[model samples]
Target: MSLLESWDRGEHTAETLRGTTATYATYRKGSGPGVVVIHEIPGLTPDVIAFGEEVVAAGFTVVMPHLFGRPEAGLSPLAVAGAMRQVCVSREFTKLATGETSPVAGWLRSLARELHTELGGPGVGALGMCFTGGFALAMMVDESVAAPVLCQPSVPFVPGRRRGADLNLSPADLGVVRERAAAGCQVLGLQYAGDPLTGTRFDTLAGEIGDAFLRVDLPGRRHSTVTTHRQQEAVDRVLAFFTERLS
Candidate 1:
């Protein structure tokens, strides 16, 4: 059977949201405080959807956006290649660029604002993975995002210290993020301690945000902390963070 079958049709309510920067379809499920679960590279693979479902079950309304790649596509070399091509050429993402936030982050922050307005909670959570990892931090510039979870944020993609340590933020946006952190907005980060894709951004985050950044440096070099790799401890930590911050 195709891994796409993993998306249970009857469970999620699909809707399209048009933002200032972009328009995309979203799958929403559960009911409580809201959390925007951004997928990893290669699109919304079955693993990513499964993780969203798990987040839903943990008592929050989860919205999974179809960003790039074939929706419900499984992770294959071809699919990954195709997605990388799109990201590389698209202005919505900042692949090898430094000191600039991806343009798509504005759209995501709009989505979070709408969710928070609808749910009327303390705030909404933004969970970004892999290529979209630094997005959660960018979205934190908006007040709607109170809980930001960054899992293996690989961006400004290139070798060397400049690209490796870039936080994928412009100078102005980085100031806002620092203010948010200082104001007690806890940013959750989970990754394999030695994952090269994650680079030294974790160290950058620590230096920029200090004690406000909650660090979860797991063992080994496996990339995806909550989706493809799907660590139970990491998931638990994520859920606990959402509950503490958003609930």
Candidate 2:
């Protein structure tokens, strides 16, 4: 069955956030801690929602943030791609969305704080993907972040351009996250074997963060499949990692 079919059958709860009013599907099963699942470039599509459900089944309250917000809400991958193209084509909108004020990392921090206090009140884990993968590490500056999983994080897409690139985290911000790692919070990362945008470069960065970094190398896997096809394995690993750390 298609992922959306399962989603519509009441397998998971379709809900909207109070502040953003952006719709997201949530799955709550286990009871120890909370986790926030960040969506990819295509937003919160079916597979990503399914991964969240799988994590809930593994014993945690999972919150999947609706990153694209209301405008292209509930869109499919193709639709999101088209919308994103338009957003990128307009340089002003792209800068506005990726700028420091509306940064992807800041929004994730908001969700983490809410999950820590309002939703579960028992600490939280973060899972970020593709363009959002680095967010989990960035969130560690806040102590509430207990565990983080980055699956083929696609920001910092090119080499050499990383230092001053839009998607690249500044050296100062990286330093703060490094401090968090030094304090012993674990950060996990995943990337496909051959994907250029997130391959060795991400590995190098993960190494710099030191012993708290756990890198998952998926052989013969590409970026999209890591989310779409092999999701069960991905979700299983994520839940296991979170359970080990958060519980």
Highest-scoring model, lDDT: 1
User: Per-residue CA lDDT of candidate 2, range 1-247, in tens?
Assistant: 5443333221222222123322234433435588877777667666676666677777787766555523224446666776577536632122322223124455466567767886554369998777667677667766788887878766554554432234345456667778878877778777767766674645556566767788767776477534564645665677788888877
The alpha-carbon lDDT assigned to residue 120 of candidate 2 equals: 54
Worst 10 residues of 1 by lDDT: 10-19
Candidate 1 C-alpha lDDT tens digits along 75-114: 8999999998888887778888899988888888878888
- For all candidates in order, the CA lDDT equals 0.87, 0.61
Per-residue lDDT, model 1, residue 208, is 97
